[model samples]
Target: MAEIVELSEADQQRKDLILRNLQESLGVDKLTKQLSTGKNIHVYWGTATTGKPHVGYMVPMQKIADFLNAGIKVTILFADVHAFLDNLKSTFEMLEYRVEYYQRVIKALLSSLDVPIEKLSFQLGSSYQLSEAYTQDVLKLCGHISQRDALRAGAEVVKQVDSPLLSGLLYPLLQAIDEQYLKADGQFGGVDQRKIFILAEEQLPKIKLGKRWHLMNPMVPGLTGGKMSSSEIDSKIDLLDKPNVVSMKIDNSVCVRGNPEENGVLQFFRFVVFPIISPRIIDIKGQSYSNYDEIVESFEEKESISAEALKEFLKAFLIGILTKVQDKCENEELRNIMNHAYSSPPELDTSELSEGFQTVLELKDMGGDRMKEIKGDCELITSAKLYQKLNTDEPLKVLWRVSAKGKVNLGHLGGLLQLKRLQALKCECSILISDIGGFLDNGKCPWNALEARAKYYEEALKQFMKAISLENVPIRHSRENQYERDYTLEMYKMASKVTKDASAIVEGNTLATHLCPLYHALDVHFADVDLLITGEEQRPFVILGQQLCQGIGLPSQAALLFPKIPGMNGERMSSSNTEQHLDPLDTVKQINKKIGSSFCEPKNVKDNVALDLARLIIFPLHEGKEVVIKRDEKYGGNVSFSDYAALEASFAEEIIHPSDLKPFVTEQINALLEPIRTALTPQSKMITAAFPKVAKKK
Candidate 1:
């Protein structure tokens, strides 16, 4: 600032509008002092011609509107040289084409916003930055600053790499000198360029150029919940996207109601929409409104808004506003400029181009390269070999060991739900109730209680399969099967085939717990399982099964591992924690209350029991149908998701609130358990025999 100078009332108002909606401002006193001198303040906003413009460009465009409305002189600088220095994102041959593409599109966007072109002008960075005086200032400023400081300045704007090009280091240096050469009173940009703004303010004084007012707009996150990049197609929506394409991009984006400021859709309303359109908003009912705070209030209150409704509003606005831009691009010359400039952008941060299917769960190949997938959850651990095997013409023979001990909880139900999913893919599944094998260390089931407990487990399994619409799957008890005549000879053959004793962990007081893993492994042989389904914690038994089969010269079975279900307390669910899981026989009130009380942290997918229930149970059951999440009218109306991936993505991004998530999961779980709870009512005698005094007390 030159000095303290008071502005007139009219110029004061102009200063306010120029500084509105900025995340940070530097040297505001300079603008006020200059405004008081009865002269129009000059401000410049620059853009590098690296990628095609997107909806994110609206932030700066709206800021430019504010400046024009304030009656200030604003210059829109197309930074062609800066773009070329940014790892050569724009080649010299295409710079002219890209610059032309930028000029046509920006003018169209500003015209659509009704910003007056009377006081607005355009400049190319090469026009002034190429002059000898500017060249002398660049070298003079270079001698005053270190390489580390220059790297720190452009760290936010440049594409970082191990050994960066010299052009990247000079990017921020040239931007600093651009302020003096453009002859502007201030530089306006996104808050992302604050580092360069600070450098221009600090290093410019060494060359004797005074500091200018630097204004910044809040950064709007990209569509997929990160910094929007032109190289990443899914993260940003292009400005020239068709109306239908705009709807599709906004529809596929995941949003939740956790933080109103962090959501890309909500931030769009605050930074771009509100400033241009004022408080006017056409809500879901198509009614006119002067107030739009209802969206933020709903997100903060008991009833949160639906992600679908808000996205629809943004979709309509974007489509309508882009109509002018897209329509103007239909000109023959404009189309030629776009085709020449963007025909072949360098592959920066793009997904691999592949012919075969990408791995859905981030699986790796034998060469250790990460495989891409169209979609998957956090629990998918597979290989190309495994994928090939599963897609073969042979029908899969799957086996799962059902425990005939303790209360049957949702943990058991989750595994069976996966078994139900496999049946649709020609899997012939067999449930082996392991009565003679591993049992809970608890005293609920003893040797005398084996028959009644096994019977109880079978009834529970039948009801679970029935609830998932499964029928006629084979069920057998391991104790009964072990007594068959051929089993005696098979046990003798199995004992001689292993490399070492399976009793390595037979220490005092926990002998059964150590030997249980080997016992479960041998069950694979008895069941003739071609593919095994179990929790990933049971992987040790699968490893032992492979060794046993190798010693006996039988083919080893492939394993499909799933992470353990999270408990109500947000820890691993266990039989030891009695209240941590929902039992199949729980009453409707109990089921709802238990699931509602489960820990469901907002935007935390890994530790949320509600999300696990949705991903593992609710979604798998509703495979072909849409899962509708009921929302209050105060929030948006109900929203339906076709697949769990979309739902999980929304939840992870906070587009889905935990409060809404818990209730929906509770409702689905109660419905799934209703029949199971009813079928187990008549079998009270079996529970009494299996659990003794414990069953009555619970």
Candidate 2:
């Protein structure tokens, strides 16, 4: 049993403010003192998957630390089962790997932060069972609520797409039930999860369980905009990022000019780092800072609070935490062995391209002339300033080369000026050669030149789709209109087709080979599309795509879509060769170390144009039935929309006018997500077929 400690008046004030902010933002009430009465407060937060715990995980971790500092009993729950449900990208083996990874990472994070790990008891979600008594209590309570209200509340609890998986719908209720099972006095999460706690409060009393539940939520914003997310790479910094990586990410963060109220970096500072560094003071020095301004100032000044300085601070902070965690993780070797007791046999390799393929020019004189011409054109186009500008600020330099045999070699092409554009040749009739068909046939076109290109592209597309799906919108591109349109159409078509094929396979009890092409096509579309929309919007669609694929029993290649944190040479970090990379542990150490030294600067107007476009053109399409506020002559004004596009465009123009879409967009998103509340309702006996119930206790 954990003991509770008393807090000083100042500490209580800080906790009160934090709790108040959380309640206001999330629409939940503060916890009673009973929940906080334990001397050792144990609050656990973890992802469903073991992929690197992103910034979202930090929210709960920080809360635990705060509670610990306040002399409360703290218990950290890994929620491994929940991780498996949420992180569909992971294989069972990968899931195991992630569990270890998180255990180590989290421990490291805590240790680095100088948090007291001794008082902390880390437990996996699966370790605790839903005892028959607990289920009976839940069912008895379920009987008290009307089915309509149950459905409505249950829907709100999950707050995600309606899942056919019984567990998905029941999970929230189960989470609430955990409070009773653990005899926890309180629960904590981000503001987004306030509804769940509310539902828990309503149902627990109905079941005759103690009504003494306390809920605490933190306000954490995304790095680019909106909410901080584990899935959105740019929105939140990974604790494992290298210093350079963290610095680059911060430099690219979204920050509004004149009004610093909505800057992502500042939000991070206010919600995450500030509480750790200076909990009582909302403003530093004479500057009146909110969550956003703190980060902006930190990045703007390269001195103590500069991007480099902050990165170093975070890096050191994280490294210290992880080091301590690593020490604890090593003690679980026996548990690790037990977890692997029923491992599956290794998969046999069946790749025909193991030896790889040769480049078009390498394949004798099959299409040598056309290959040379195309290669020359590629080089010229790559060197053009316009083309380079179209690609990246770093210039459209070639980062890697694929040999005829599909062997990848790293190199850099100096500038776009060195390359010629084949499109230019297409404009002149004299330059049009019939032999150009040879280029296509011999794989001389850029599309076919590299074996890994499509793979990489597909990976990027999947990531893009996942990002868009979360926000429920199509991705927008500023350039290459035709390409973007074609890619979007292809993606939707692929999704529809794959969904149909997957249904057929599931119904017929057939294997899923037929669905592979659709999956591949969808993947390819995402990759090609991502190149065009990389920095424009938070790619929610990519995350959604991964979830969809996983739901449909397809492999989610999410690992491939993670943005490459460029190496010192401006090339993506690679582990393929000895000279190019360090081992995983070393890489983790380097990232942890480097992240501390880096700093994140706020994004300027010109840099965040894409995010602006997304807020304007894309976001509204998914607004569903949310009401929009309009100023009018009669009774002020309220305009609601079923047309997402019109609403999105209107909101973009109105709210994001000259670059301020944070408030409007977030408000609309909250409305759009309201329907998900119904999905969280507790299922009744009529729908009890959805879940496999545990037998009643003897």
Candidate 3:
């Protein structure tokens, strides 16, 4: 119910260019106001020269051309410094050459797309980034940015295969400052770069640089449907690909029928091909369409066009685009630049690791003996280098708590299963013997250990107690009584009292009786653990620890909370519930007997024990192999499922009866536990020693 405000012709055209293929816009009103006033707006977009320029690169480049047409001054940055920080596959020697290749190829692409090359300016990151002024700015900004803030900013673009690099943290800060240094009116990139752009818009004004508008293009999907990345060759079509290669890749693309969002082919045409090359002609079965819209409309309606026919049309269209672009890129001058760049190597900057801490270490490099040495360091690790090693570096050192609390619980055992999967995936996984029991020997009770650690985090603990006190109980809920009972105001009062009063630390009659949840929180900091794996039940305590630790300048550790596995009798599995639990050392026959007698409701997969075992244990243990169920000819023989979903669907729909499902699940369980049972044999003294002894009743 508001009056409409119209845009001027110049402003309208500017809006069209800015909005085309753009996912989101910030400061649009400001940008449009500037455009309407005929002020020259300068915009810059950049890319790392790590991967070969792919067709996906066309999205941003095409937009850059639109800016030039809109009478906006355009600058393109080749982010070589960012590429190095990102640890692109290229060696340091190849960065300069790679940048040259990017520039030349980008020029050819822009020219082919009808953008005015002469109107554009290009800048390499190192040109001004290495300057004294810029270096000072980067160092100055680092003081304001927390490692957690930096990490969150770069999360989308940075590679986080294992432990992330410190350079990754610096990457976003540099990118945010790039706009300030260039003195540009705006910056542009893919939607993934939005985080850094937002950070820049916030931080630039703080550093005395005016805020700039952000224009981001939608990420083009690979032929297989996810965002096209340069690292995944099969996922994307490289710019330099020959006509035959391009055609074949498109022909084999996974474009689901009638679904544009999931179909990479349709997305490419909508975002990339159509905007640049319109009035596209398509002839299918002797019928002619004037443009891409006609074909797409028919395809969506499921009338004339089919996926196969669409793929054929796509192959032809891509071949034409790639052929033209390839011809221009292969020009003698451009080829010479590429060849020169390829041959002339630059020195690799390996200094990022040498400075602070080596976060990434190849498990192979640190032989078994070295790993054993690390495992022996059960004492508190307070060194910054050691802290960084666990937090950010590769080959994540896992600490398996070997406490004398009792036999390792199912929750801890489940964590071990996850660790096994991580180890199999080439992650550094190791066990750490907890020194809590040993530390208690130095004092009478757990409070003594807590008091010793309390002096270091007293102020932070006080702040945490005050912070948590503000969270009022959900008194209105149906289960409010339970919540009030568990998290009482008096409990918080006690926590606050304990934070300040030394007398609150009490000596108990026994080591086990003296246990405090507060000690677990302290152990996290004392051990300098990066990631803490535990059951969901421990979430509140972990949150408490994280809140207190953050005040002490420590980042909250990432948590992987695996849900509690239900027992075979469809209840919480514990030693008290004998029918619900099965021993790890149970024989195959015993397991089969136990599972055959366990609960599995017909048609219901939710909280189903048999299915849970198949999901958590059997499937992960099999790792890509199918779980085959043998059946008689009359009942449908030899049904196999490649994944948990397929198996689950079959069971839910009653395609496989519970009578058949139970035995198959049991067999898989026995197969999974065979190796584990063997490792826990009497001869495996070290393995047996790792688990705490089960306490016996008097």
Candidate 4:
């Protein structure tokens, strides 16, 4: 048996630095005890061929290599099954190919680093014999937990009920069982998988296993922000990407000035590559030369650190990694075995020429015929690919066609139109009214058009209304108040207005009928409201909205209702309470209370209730426009007599009414306000005295 090797002073220093970097980057500690246990530590890593693996993979790959060098056996598992669960586009065959591809690449990467292949073993999860022990453990785990708890523990809440087959739910459990099968000391993944890892950890102890599973996660910055992903192309640099592509990607990567800590490229260097090289300074020097120009100068003078030189270095480094992987893939014997194993799946053999065989053959034939019959029933309407050229000279009349097979929905269509750079025309169809109008009239074009053939636009709208009503039915109403009825009536009124508008357009009697769906789609798609305030002529203009909400005492819940403009953070204003961390109504109340508390008290009568209200409500509502309220002390009342109505109408037309705040509106607003009301009792009392109260009936 191989004895664990002790590190030298220099090696120890490198190990410490690497572990520190990893711990900081991942916000987790390394398996220090595991490293010193004198046992072979193996790390197996593979990505399902969901397109190509990006730089996000580097974090785990580098960490695994670091652990391997620290005297542990590392087994890299290409989680082909997990990939199938995660990636919708990945087929079993494709997964097999991806596993092979990753195996080659991983091997090459190790070889280029001069890491020993003897200590590293790359294996496919699907190829590993399904351990009966693991299967029984999984069945036991399933039995121990309620279905709800199991679903919650598995992170299956976010997934739609029908989207995941039974296998998808079992995926996490299987992954947990993988630890038992592999006898892995630890597992590593992104922070998003924390729940899954925790489940595994919990389940392991119950199995009478004394060993605790270690989990290591690394921070991989995304293209826009937050966690990096293979899906977001700009967020990561692929190892296989060309030099120009890599340079452009890195150049465009988000960089923080005076804060090198979170810069994506710097983080990549610190976390992914720093621990591998013996001398840290040399690695730093290799990454960053004197300057781009100086590097160019050096390259011109001595062919060093030039763009070309760097490109060469990157290419060689990548190719060196890929070459070893490719060599492994070219291993005819292994390839043949994998091919045979995958092609001939170990399913029940019905080829014994028995009664069951005949029955299966007959069923297969019937199934084929039934599939053909179903295909015959379907009709192809249009063949317009998203982002492809349009033949219409009258501007693209993009309509929402609800085919069962169609991927693009009304929401998706709205998103697509927002990207088009064209003059949007009006529409004349009355049939296209609904939130579709809200999407269109918001300033882009009418992107929510019904297909000329589909007769379910109205029905779809009704269903949508029913869904919304059921989801957000009103409460907190006295029987006399008719609150629920009032809200329902208002919703119907809104729907009626939509129907009227759509009908008028459909009848071809209005200029609006010429409106294109593309423009409407853009309008709704980019409906986030941002406030632009111009200062003095010489001063730069200030852009504010959601950011200012917190400053003005807006509740966290309400503040979050306002969408974060792109580049604000990686996430949007999520309506999902779990994701947003607060209920929408609570958020609104928080904002209202915060603003009420922060309102500056002015000694002058001019800056009283009306003035303050204008500042607090009107200005913000008007997208930060300063407002003046006229009041007469003689009348003992205040009213806006200025062209404020017209200004507000225009503001509503330009901003408020067009903005899609509907999604963020909550039915429990009154309930949320109870706490705020209690907090502001004194203020409310004072304000009530200022405004005349209606006399009570006897």
Every model: Cα RMSD to truth: 29.3, 28.9, 24.3, 24.3
Worst 10 residues of 1 by lDDT: 367-376
- The models' CA-based lDDT, in order, is 0.71, 0.41, 0.61, 0.38
lDDT of 3 by residue, 1-698 (tens): 43344679768977786777688988787787777667878988988777788998888888887888777898999987777655334444577778988987888777777789999999998777665467545644654555456667888897653445445666788888898778788989999988898888877675576788998888988888788998888889887888788888888888776567888888877777676665565476677766556767777874676778777766776677667777877778767666665563344333323112233434443443333444321222222334455443366544333232222223234545655554543455443333342223222212223222222122222222222221211111111121132222112212222221121122332212112333444444444444555555555545544443432333444444556666777765553355557655566777788888877888888878888878776676567888788888899898998999998899899988888888888776665556545544443444244332445747
Query: lDDT tens digits, residues 1-698, model 4?
Result: 43456655655654564364344222122344344443455443434444456656656766666666566566777776666555234446666666766666566556655667777776677664244344335544543333344455556222435333333455566666676667676666655666666767666565554344444556666645666766567787655565567666655665443344555544544455444442433322355543333333444455444333343443444445545544544557555644543353233222222111112122245434432332222221111111121222222322221121111111221111211111122211111222223212221112222221122223333233232221221111011121133222222122211212222222232222212222222221122211111111101001111111222222111000111211001222221122222222235555334233321223232222222233222333333344333234553333332334543443344332211111111212233334433443444333333222334758
Off by over 4 Å in 3: 1-7, 279-296, 331-698
Clashing pairs in 1: 255-655, 256-654, 256-655, 256-656, 359-372, 359-373
Q: Can you list the residue pairs that collide in candidate 3?
A: 92-348, 93-346, 359-393, 359-394, 360-394
Model 2 Cα lDDT, one tens digit per residue, 517-547: 3323243234332121111111333334444
| Candidate 1 C-alpha error for residue 460, in Å | 99
lDDT tens digits, residues 261-380, model 1?
557777666666666677455555454434446667764574455677778888888888899787877788998888899776443322322122255543226223211221123243
Scored by lDDT, the top model is 1
Comparison by lDDT, 1 against 4, better one: 1
Ranking of candidates on lDDT, top first: 1, 3, 2, 4
- TM-score: which is higher, 1 or 2? 1
Stretch of 10 with least lDDT, candidate 3: 470-479
Note the clash tally of each candidate: 6, 106, 5, 50
Q: Where does candidate 4 have its weakest 10-residue lDDT segment?
A: 534-543
